[model samples]
Target: MAARLLIGVLAVSGLGLALSLVAGTVLLRDYLYGRVAEQVSGLSQAPDVRPGAIAPSRLCEVTDAPAVLPSDFRLTVIEADGSVRCRVPGDQTGPPVPSVDELRDWADDDAAAVVRDDSGSWATSVDAFDQPGRDGGKGYVMVAISLRNADLTVQRVAVGGAAIGVVVLAVLALAGRMVIRIGLRPLTDVREAAREIRHGDLSARVPPGKPGTEVADLSTALNSMLEEIQRGFEKRRESEQRIRQFATDASHELRTPLTSIKGYAQLYAQMAARNTGSDAGTSIAREARKDVEQRRAEVVSRIDSEADRMSGIVEDLLLLARLDQQPELVKERVDLVEIAHDVLTAARAGHPERRLDLKVEGPVEVEGDPGRLQQVVANLVTNAIVHTPSAIVVAAATTDGVAVLEVRDDGPGMPAEVQHRIFDRFYRADVGRSRRSGGSGLGLSIVRALVEAHGGSLECVSSVARGSTFTVTLPRAS
Candidate 1:
């Protein structure tokens, strides 16, 4: 993230710098060209050419061999005779023809200039001077200078700016790493603390020092997590204790029943082995049959009840395990209303007498795992069915960019205290009643986990004996 941040910042800066350099170069070119054009116009628009009639041979002495004389050009320059003075033919390198043409509209007596093409590339600036003749006649005088060398000045500025930008970027990157290293020092300490904690040092804590900005927030978050872990360990210990106690108590309870059943069975067997009267045999057989039947029924009931409880526990554990191991969901749009109706149809079977106030409304689609999300909805609806007293009203709709499916049951509303603990595993408001009613106590917990896995939120409102309402909100795909 840090490296990318730096690159993003530099990319923006580089672009701005490049654009500024380009604009500055263009402006400078215009300025330089304007200055040279003004000089040429000034000399050409004058009343007459003056003293110096520098020949190409002499001009080459002062200027480079690449220089051109100003009196020769393709364009017609109006001389003092009102006739066009086409290039009077000087074997000299000259200034830019474009610049000379721009200056051709000068006064009649002005030093009318022309462009000369001595070098293959004509690149220069020109100036003209008028020399007075013997009888007040006009003689044209022209001066030339090359532009190829002068324009190099503009390019240098652009190159210099680009070089400076590169230097600035290098300096920032070098200094930025040092700054980030210093900035993240506190995090390094926190990381080390976490590593040590992972290795069984539960008592380890980040030093309560003011490390720096947001270090406090990081510490607070980590501390909260550790505190939660500590509390979870305590809960597990308590749960294990309960399990052991239940195992011991259940074994003791089973032993008494087993002894009674075994004693009766043995007594019947002994009588059958000794007593040989036909009437006696029949009497013993009847008595033994009754005892065996009663014992068998009691054993079956115990096993069935306990097995149900154990199975529910296993299912809850499995659901939680799946939730923790969030697998990739096959995301696709599915109409949830159809699934809701199907679930409702199943739930109705459980409560035939109760007036099921169900409201199913939809056609709203969502991007989610269809099966898991359907399970979530089913659990929530079932929870309400078991808890609500009056009527179960389910409604599905698409609203406010979210596909909201709500199940409200007019049952006994749960108190705030019970509502707080309802989503916990093995938690039940009326434990005795819930168990008797075949409640596994994991329904709500499973519901919550499934909702979260879909990146959705589930909320419940309960009024004891009045009703409990559960609202599920999922993002709409269409």
Candidate 2:
């Protein structure tokens, strides 16, 4: 690119220099030729020549001739009889005499002509005069000044101008090359950055250019695009990783329940087979059957409980999938305080020994799906009650044009790191304890998704041993 730009610059500059040199040379040559013509015309009007009276040997002598004539100046006389005589200043041989036909062609005294001969080129003019004693016979006086000096001067100027033009072009090419390289440096940086990005280096960036220049604007635009692309790649990678982890966790969770169900079924089958093959008295067989029935009942109850747990996990997973797809929600005005009250009431009934409290500052009306909002309140309250041994407080209020619901517990709170990923599906802070307590770990995840779907946000503030507070903020009903 730099080379192309440099070439373009040189081409334009060189063309301009060439045209200037040509024009200067042409103007100078014309001016020089005009000056020579003027000199020849002045010399032609000199009253020095009397061709008929001068002897052939003394035709070159002229008393009235300019004493300072140029050494290369020549004079020629042609009498009526077609006799020609030529004379040059300072003994320099001049151009050959003009032929009779050529002299006849220059019959006008005011006309000037350029004549070239073996000696050199000359600017020549002719003046006709009648001889004092001749009858209808005229003599011609011709004056010529050499054009060699003018031509040489023009030639020198042309050559010199061309040489200077070449030098200027060379200098311009060098300077233009440097300027083009510097100007295109930003583009070079951008190309390298793009190449690096293509090779999987997302952090590479183009160097900045001068403000308000086209290259700067381009750099800014390309940088923005690269940043967006990098962000997109990061998000995609993170999503894939989450999907893999989710699949693994889901499989593990289902396997646990399936393993228990399988074991209980096999035990039930063994108990039945043993009873059927027993060869005993009727009372003994009857007692054996009663015991087997009681054991089978316990086994079937456990199997049902595992199946219910598995069903809950599947249902939560499906709900998350739907939320991920951004399903349309049933939007309506719902009172968050009422939802908190109901969730607290259920908690109290479920855990009579544990103290649960509900605080309502106001109606806290918000626009959202009622079922989903209630579920959100229930999940947060349940999580507090299950994780903390202290009394749980579920509160709802309207603050700053938004409906806020907070579930607080004075228990062993979590660390900052745990709070950050608490809403991740199937992520448990206390994995063993959560599994033993039949916690599916999808409760908080579902809560977050539901809140976001309603154009709300969920946040958890926690610190070890102090307390944990889960706050959900939703837009107030308008």
- Candidate 1 C-alpha lDDT tens digits along 1-478: 5577567767887788788889998999777766655555564333332234443223323332223324332112234443334332334333443433354443333333334455422222233334245355442333444444446888788789889988977887777767776767667778888898889887677755475647877887788888888788889988898668545544443454455556655655554454343343577767766665566566566655655555556666777887879866779887778778888788789778766554655487889888887888788777666655566777889989998888887666879998887776656666453334536566787888888888889887776667777888988885
Give stretches of model 1 more than 4 Å off: 1-298, 301-305, 431-434, 463-466
Per-model TM values vs. the true structure: 0.42, 0.89
Worst lDDT 10-window in candidate 1: 57-66
lDDT of each: 0.63, 0.82
Which numbered prediction scores highest in lDDT against the true structure? 2
What lDDT score is found at residue 423 in candidate 1? 76
The candidate that achieves the highest TM-score relative to the unseen native structure:
2
lDDT of 2 by residue, 217-310 (tens): 8989999988999999999999999889788889888998999999999999999898889766788888888899899999999999999999
What is the Cα-based TM-score of model 1? 0.42
What's model 2's lDDT at 317? 93
